[model samples]
Target: MPDATQDAAARILAAVRAIPRGQVAGYGEVARRAGLPGRARLAARVLSQNTDRTLPWHRVLRADGRIAFPEGSAGYREQCQRLRAEGVAVVDGRVRRELMAGAHGDLDAMVWGPPPR
Candidate 1:
């Protein structure tokens, strides 16, 4: 099972890496995209230990679009700043979905392109 676990981690990392700049996805959504449904917490755990700064860990949030950090904490402030730098509006501790809703709320479309016009 070690290999399976390692692969799962890899998949989760890949999913997180796939999040486009200026856009964000929920932890649950990231897990689902990694083919690990119902494992949002696992995704969060993996992220907490993430050392690769390029992974864009700030792009992952609760399903409600809120940053997971305490409202006034350093992490909260940093995440808000980083997200805003990417042009993702975080208003009232939650991302305004309309601003970041370009594509991929649907996993299939995220992997493949939208259906023919």
Candidate 2:
């Protein structure tokens, strides 16, 4: 019964869940991996709507490594808690990239496919 947008969002969430523990992906990255390039806002919207559970939603963050949830908000606290639980270092409500796992794809492979362009 899901609409096209909802189905797309679900696909994005599934991609997000594929992110291994201790790693994180930016909103834009999630969108791109979900086959919806330049749709970071849509990714965020989907995540927001499904925050009630069933997805590893906390693994998605802003491009600058900051938790997208606003500071002092319930979601922010939950995000920090979740990241910390996953061994992802969080300071000042932001993730420290050096302390977390790197992204999955390599430069050439990411842009040109695994076999190269």
Candidate 3:
């Protein structure tokens, strides 16, 4: 059985997976949605540690629309490719915030899950 922290991380991953294609949420947003405010780094760490191949891990990004993975890395390339395939516009290796804004309707609902406690 997973420890409490592991279980929490799993739950966070589940919430992240719920974000639809063509849409992305910020790391801080994911943390807040996972019932762990101020734990954005923890959320990122959980995603990095994830071994689940099916998780749409590419759909999460920094708040500035920049890919979270390091530049020139395989993960960075994969993230760009995934976003492109989903019709999200990425320019100069960065996603345009305007494009993301248009793609993600109901912005608050898309990023934030429940009301923060």
Point out the worst 10-residue segment of candidate 2 by lDDT: 99-108
Per-residue lDDT of candidate 1, residues 1-117 (tens digit): 499888988999999888888878889888988999999999999998888877799999888788999999999999999999998888988997643333335644654666666
- Among these predicted structures, which one has the highest lDDT? 1
Query: Which has the better TM-score: candidate 2, or candidate 3?
Result: 3
TM-score of each: 0.85, 0.79, 0.80
In the predicted model 2, the residue pairs found to clash are none
lDDT of 2 by residue, 1-73 (tens): 4598877887798878877777778888788878898998999988887856768888889878899877999
- How well does model 3 score by local distance difference test? 0.78
Where does candidate 1 stray beyond 4 Å? Answer: 99-104, 107-112, 115-117
Top-TM-score candidate index: 1
What does candidate 1 score on TM? 0.85
Q: Write the per-residue lDDT of candidate 3 for residues 41-108, one digit (tens) a residue.
A: 98899999899999988878887888977899998999999889999888767787754432455445
Prediction-by-prediction clash tally? 0, 0, 0
Each prediction's Cα lDDT score? 0.84, 0.78, 0.78
